[model samples]
Target: MVEAVSRNSFKAYDIRGKVPLELNSTVAYRLGRAYTELFQAKKVAVGRDVRHSSPELVKALTEGLLDGGCDVIDIGLCGTEQIYFATFHWQLDGGIMITASHNPQGYNGMKLVRANARPISGDSGLRELEERVVTSAFAEPVGAHRGNVQVCEVMPDYVQHLLSYVDIAAMRPLKVVVNAGNGCAGPVIDALERYLPFSFVKIHHEPDGEFPNGIPNPLLPENRDATAQAVRKHGADVGIAWDGDFDRCFLFDENGDFIEGYYLVGFLAQAFLGRFPGAKIVHDPRLTLNTIEITRQLGGVPVQSKTGHAFIKERMRLEDAIYGGEMSAHHYFRDFAYCDSGMIPWLLVLDIMSREGKTLSELVQERIDRYPCSGEINRRVSSPQVVLESVEKAYAPGGQIDRTDGISVEYANWRFNLRMSNTEPLIRLNVETRGDRKLLQRKTEELLVIIDGFA
Candidate 1:
């Protein structure tokens, strides 16, 4: 009998868990072989983030892939998007990124994609992949016919593609503070610096697997202070910070005020609609008024998709949307294989600031005032489903209900979305009002009361 491999890391979207016990090199090696056999992938590209365990995991993963007669192009030490870029840009068979992506230091994970950079999630292929790995179902390696590994550099070409999104010559020189959070974005920023005309004030900019400053998640209130302070200290036009794998980026205004990601969705949609008139823009269900209103005002279609990268990308492909954004800071581009990029959003924001001769705050303030939101608040509970149904039962009668990804009830002046977390026993809540801060506060508390009652 084969010893069982832990399946704890196999999430709905990707594989992520604590290292050694949950996701060791043994598990990675088996996954590689199983992935090769399942997809019959001939040419695969693999990349890793700035995590200590990543290198070892990549080695074992590559060995298994090679054993299964798959040629491996190792794009060493890169953000998650770089693997996506390599897969689609080079027209390779598949790609795997070894990154836990803003998870704590002792954790690591992998994000897989097939040709054209299409996501491979639980409903897609990850479940089948998990079964194979668990059962040790893989063909024996024929040593004589094993494939080879090649180390390839993708930065120069990647930088060129990033610059193609905006007119560099039209951009004005502005002071910008960039916090890499000791992740993989620093190198990409360095590569793009020579081509752009901005003075960058770098903080924790170096890529360190140790994550000396912290785990690099800017979504947490405490993790945002560094970037905000830098922006104020330098009097920069805007401040940008990215997570461990540099997949989702967060922004801060000139006064060190953190700009909510919901507003940025509308901000980016407006930018794209300005250039590509009547284009379709995809947004998540968490927050919608600002994005929908802005998209409509600009004569662009706003398509709402369920939250998560796979769903958003699929929706974008179905709609052929010009852009897709989740309030969580994941921005997807049609040209970039409908894949999210932490780098692209900032570049576009800067371009908008440059051309309009406006500060980052000025560009997004109108939308913020129009849609005051209670940013995603999470509460631990005994039964998340019970709480969701309770909230829905209470509010569904009087409001317009949307059950796309979660329970969203919209009234005349206020709207709220209450959804259960995919990985935790927590219910995530988001409330927004039509320019009413007081209403936003009251409803948020009211919903919390209902949630706390269940607790």
Candidate 2:
């Protein structure tokens, strides 16, 4: 039986925690063994990010998988999506990505998937895996029948698949600012540069596990200046930034203004609806009016799923949605096994700009003015349930209340969604208004006051 292991890392979606304490070589090895036993995986693909602890953890994980008689295909030093690609692209039994995404340094995690690259989150198989790892549910290695390891290169084909999303010949010669934030996206940009016409002004481009330029999450307002300044300095037409694992990408306009991911949801929804009329577009509930209007205007259906990758992917498959997006910058495609891709969103945006003969700002300026939103604001609280109840009690009286994911209260001219973070101990609030920035600001402040009351 395995000794007691830290269960704090087993989150609702993936495994993430501080190095050695919550996650270490021992945990990774048992996880690999539990995963093989749970899914009966014979051949699995394993990929990892540039975290300092990744290589050591991956080494132990591989040994455990082999001990379980599961052959391992190592796709080294890759982003999370690469593991998904390697699994589906190679028809492997499953895939495991060693990454902590945007988490701070000295921390790491893993994203797991079964065949077809479908996520194995808490409800599906992760809970079982956790139980096994916690209680010692692994058998000894079959010495004679141990699995072998093979190193495979997935970058070339992955790049080709990304290029398939846009018409290369139609792309204009525009200067684009690409910021990898010292994560995994730099190599991807380099690989795609030769095939594109855009000149890239790269920033924090190399994969440095130490995070010399800070964590690659552009979602925070402070982390965005580097990408925005690069665009202004280089007179670039657009800017793009990706997180550590590159599953989510953020965009900036030619004016060096950071575009909210909420706007991009409606923008990309419109793009997909233009190509596939009457198709279903799945979106999260946090920010919805803009996406709903655009989807309906373009003769497409708007489906609202809970704000999460696992939930969104399931909804996409259930509705056969052509596309899915979150205000948090995760954009999913039907063609890419319903998996989210940070690379694909920017390429599609470039295609739209090239075809419409409009700048990035021009493309989204109207929507921005029409549906101004207070970008997602997070506040740490002691009791999230109490805070949520208080907000719902105060706001749900006259407004339309929807509890699909959280308490989303909508009035005729304004709307806001209040939900607790799934991974962290914080309450997240998103507020938007119909062409009224003043009302948006007022309501956001009002909500913050109520949220802060409990704290």
Candidate 3:
């Protein structure tokens, strides 16, 4: 079934494709052999999300790993970060997670990491692995090798690791709505609830691959209403929603308001900077001013990196950054092997609110107002590169331009970033200004007009 599978399954960041067609047991098996051979790995950790196809993929992959003389530590039914945790926390040679992560059901994927949970993306060994998986002659069948496979539970240790981030002694009682969206997050939330003091109103808490309420991507407008409504319905202090694999989480304020990830990056930057004065913090180039301004306000250094987890993590390590945040809700902590963690972000926010006795909105509202931003807007175009070029040319007369990750043109009061998608024929635009929401809106519209005309 996997012989004719599309190479599109091998993405820029990870391997993701629709089940049984583009991705299946045979493909997973081939990938396993290739990964083990490429890394020359002897011992590795394997984890799987709650997708129905995950079990077969996991088994097939493990079989191939075993055939390649690699012993597998299977942390069964885990989120992407759990495998990351196991690989780093246990000092294993490598790890792979079977998950599509917020994609629609019937879609499945894998995320790979080397020791210390360092990401293995396209530019960093994924391409080589892709070639190996296709061209190399993989080894013998499932039971043909002598390598060992062990089933282990790392939840207790993982929860303990999460608890290590904060003191937790001064934490206040806060009613929070946790919407797991029927993914792997439910179990982690349940585990944390037993140790933490907050009252949780759990919604869609099952680890169901059927995904009765639809895929768990909270970034989608349709998916967010449930979490917002739950926050309102429960009269909770905040709402938390996660994707299918729970690597990224979204937040909602007490008034059923969805908090944009961009603002949260600034908020977390401040929190970390306050604690570790003059610490380095890394942010993506898509939206810059708020993060840069806030980090500087507290005598901390703000470094901008190209977008994507692998790139961000690499930069954070290079600078010894205390934290890194993508405006897309993926937060990384220095204490967490410089890898991204969705669970730690919400926990840190709660700790911050409890310490300050301020609402979630109160902590971020000022920053959001000062730098009102046009949250990312994606427009499909026939020639996304042409549209980007046209926008760059139009804005070139006045604003300073940067090609860090995309086309970012800046003025004193307002700026906008236009980046074409790596996997799709779409240009994503983000506009922002200094306390000028109207300017943000107007600039966004002006760019859209240019983009539309080009289209």
**CA lDDT of every candidate:** 0.93, 0.93, 0.90
- Greater lDDT among 1 and 3 belongs to 1
Off by over 4 Å in 3: 1-5, 139-145
**Alpha-carbon lDDT of model 2:** 0.93
Query: Across residues 189-238, which tens digit of lDDT does each residue of candidate 2 receive?
Result: 99999999999899999999999999989998999999899999989999
> In terms of TM-score, which candidate is stronger, 2 or 3?
2
- Please report the TM-score between candidate 2 and the true structure: 0.99
**Clashing residue pairs for model 1:** none
TM-scores for candidates 1 onward, in order: 0.99, 0.99, 0.98
Cα RMSD to native, each candidate?
A: 0.8, 0.9, 1.6
Across residues 1-455, which tens digit of lDDT does each residue of candidate 3 receive?
A: 23453676999999999988888888898888898889988889999998899999999999888888899999999898899999989999999999999887788999999989899998999999888776776655466455799999999999999998766888999999998889999999989988898999999998999998888998888889998988888899999999988889999999989999999898899888878999999999888899999899899999999999999999999999999999988899888889889899999899999999999989888888999988889899999888988888889888898898889999989988889898899889888999997887888888899998855
Error of 3 at 19 (Å): 1.5
